[model samples]
Target: MSVSATHAAGPPAGGPPPSGRRNYARSYWLFAAPAAVVVAAVMVFPWLFTLYMSVHDWKVSGATPFVGLANYAKMLSDDRFLWAIIRTLIFTAGAVIAPVILGVWAAVTFAGNFLGRGIARTVFVLPMMATPVAISLVWTMMFHPQLGVLNYLLSLVGLPPFGWVYDTTTVIPTLVMVETWQWTPLVMLIVLGGIASLPQDPYEAAVLDGATPWQRFWHITLPLAWPFVVVAAAIRMIDALKTFDTIYVITLGGPGTASETLNILLYQTAFAYYDLGYGSAMVVVFFVIILVITLLMLGYRQKGIVT
Candidate 1:
């Protein structure tokens, strides 16, 4: 119980020794090794292989010859690839902007006390829960020019039957509508959390000052929740850039290459045409595009957080 005696006791009963700490560290790594191996196998190796393939001429059948940027050069020259880039930008813009706007509106509407609020929110998010392929299939049926319910409704309103995905001019926009419908709820949830977390002091002050609903939202709520909106936009932008399943199921980039985004063209090149090398190059480019955009968005987010 004396100080000297206590010093000679080394440490308290449950205190770990250096040996135990070493063993704990070893056990930590031991438990982590399987996950590390799985990550390397599934992610790292495939990425390295894709990079290697991108510099080669591999068609999965014949010789895999190293061509070194030839595939990239070819992509630059291919008009279809150029068009795919344009269409991807267009689709991504529509998909992201529409969802952000709609989601913000929905969040603001749902943030109030209302009857059946729970049920209404549940119904609103149903599209987000549905499988993309299944939704695409159902939408395909509804998009039918003649027999579809959409066209039938149009007829009842005295509007003519219109091509949804069947026309090249409308395909990308149509797909964007699908993307917006499915993803707006996710954005709403994110913004709603932000809105919920906002301090009520500003709103109360604004109300006391005789501020209108639009003025309160414009001057206070939107500014406070802007970061959350930006986060939602970044997520939506990334997802929109890589959309494939819905596009494949709905249009298959059809009516020409009008609906062909980078993802669709890459799939066609790699799987459909069996041009693995070319597809690898496209993947590399697509990854770079995503990386740059993500970095910019994240930087903006950090700035917002800091400010």
Candidate 2:
């Protein structure tokens, strides 16, 4: 007995028969529909609603009237909002720079053969595992003006007892210190991975030429490891910009709103003051800022890679 012409052709070249393909596609869509719906519900709807709210006069109890760009315009002349942007930028800079510098140094040091290296690295990275809220609480106690161990240590060095987070001038630096201590290990790990993957030929050549340690680092390790540094900086920048748990737990934007970054201000506006429209406007701006920064960093990284 011979098979029919259509049956001899078998399935299509790429996959199953037409009907089977249709069934497979149906199954694929069925499996993906729940995730798509979830994303639409959780992300898409919220973002769209926020954008909608941003162009309206949306209060918790009052009528939500569409007001065009009035909410966004309000941010332009708002002193507190402008100051919040400045503070946030400053904090992000400190957070990114301090960690990158210290982390690179730590990576360089730990990359060499040393006794108890594993234990030391573990101790350094322990802070990264700690919860921000818990770390903030512990740091808060240590930041006390008079009774804090930090102040006592300063006194032992014949230095004046300084305010850690209380004074406006010192508050940002104090927060940055906390951020640096907790996150430097992350940068170290990233850079160390990069360093580990680096070619040894350049270092060998430099050593033969009698290059100093500093020269070798500057001429070789730094250029090769820069891309990793950029990545670490980008992560830290985003994290610092949106840092809330630690800042909220510690200062709550206190000392006359001296520590009020955009996140803190946004929280107060939306939840505390119930001004949803203005808060939404702030959110849009905040998102744009983050997006721009991220793009710039990625562009730089891409450029570096290409070169």
Candidate 3:
């Protein structure tokens, strides 16, 4: 038969020849459709609603009036919101930096065949397994200037007892310290996985060249481990940016808004203040900040550096 005649006619005896691509495409929708539907239901719908709320003036009990960006404009002149953004940046930086540094150190330490390495690994990651609420409560008690064990330790060393989460001057730093302690183990676990997967050939070669321990880490290890470190850092940044339970439980965002990050402020605005429209705007802005951060981190990650 000619090409046009054969094409117009149906398949031969049984059926048309099977196609791998067509079969795979069919299977893809079969699996992905449910997940896509779920994402739209949970993530997309909420975001769309939040966007809707953001452009109107709606309190908990009031006639919802469409205000056309007035709520967003208010954010420009809102000092508390501006301060929340600044404090959020501070909290994110402090929370990410301490965990990453300490985690990398812990991972490197555990990578060695030292005594108690296995036990140390287990002990180290235990904090990550505990509930954040429980962790916050424990830290809150420990931060008490006179009654806490931490202050008592200072007295033994002839140092003055310090107010941790209670004092305005130290509240943010203290919360960061608590967060760093609780979350560093997570970073350590991630970095340890990366370290465990690293090739030994480079280290062996470095040793053959009479390289010192520090040199091996600085040259061979660090370059190979940079990607893993970035992954850990990104995860920590997102977690820190959305932190609320710890600050809420410990200080409730102050000794006068000293520890009020965006998350806490958003919570207080939406529920406590009952300004749903303005709160919705804050939510959108908060989300945009996180999205921008995620994009910047991912974009920088795409730019291949070191190794």
Candidate 4:
């Protein structure tokens, strides 16, 4: 029969009529409406509010007045804010790099079949699971200038006890150490899982070809593990960039604001200085930084995967 004659005699012959697409779309929206509402209420509303606040001169107790881009202009010239950006970048880099390096090494070592490996892994992961505030307080005591255990250990080693958080030069590094100690286990877990999931055939084949352990690791294991490493590093980088609680609990951005990161500066500006508009502007800048970094990391990951 001709196509038009068949269509006239019966339903259309395609897999599903166009009506099915309408039904599918309706069903999808039915399922998606609740999630969309929740996201709009929780995430979208707050973001829109913050963006609105960023463009106005809103004091804590006063009426908000539209101020164009004045807040952003002021931020550009604020020396302390500039310093905070530099400090934040330094801390984020240090926190991400050191933890990943140390964690990957630890994961590689623990990947071997050894006695008490489970216990060791649990112990190492304990810090990562601990509450950040609790860890910060404990580390604060340990980082105390004169009487901390860290200083005592220095004394034991016949070295002068260096002030950690108290010293301007050491504050950022001290925070990095605290962050690294707590987060290294997270990286280790990702690396370990990646390593464990890796196919053993490649390693066995390399061994059969008389490849040394180092050669095998450098050539095969590292490449296979790169995806997990990239993912873990990205996560850690994002968290490190936004770190606030531990630093707040430890330094309160004191010692002359030496450890004041963007978050801390935002807090101080909004709460301490009662400059809500300016604080919101800082937050917007921070959000931009985070977005840029995330995009770069994701782009790099995509490129790596493609290659």
Each model's lDDT: 0.94, 0.94, 0.90, 0.93
How much lDDT does candidate 3 score?
0.90
Rank order by TM-score, top first? 2, 1, 4, 3
Give me candidate 3's TM-score against the actual structure.
0.90
Clash pairs for candidate 2: none
Give TM-scores for every candidate, taking all chains together and pairing residue i with residue i: 0.93, 0.94, 0.90, 0.93
Tell how far residue 253 is off in model 2, in angstroms: 1.0
Candidate 3 clashing pairs, residues 3+ apart or interchain: none
- lDDT per residue (tens digit) for residues 33-65 in model 3: 999999999999999999999998988996999
Q: Give the Cα error of residue 238 in candidate 3, in Å.
A: 0.5
Model 3 Cα shift for residue 1 (angstroms): 7.6
Q: Residue-wise lDDT of candidate 4 within 51-104, one digit each (tens)? A: 899999999787898999999999878999999999999999999999999999
User: Which pairs of residues collide in model 1?
Assistant: none
lDDT of candidate 4? Answer: 0.93
Candidate 4, poorest ten consecutive residues by summed lDDT: 9-18
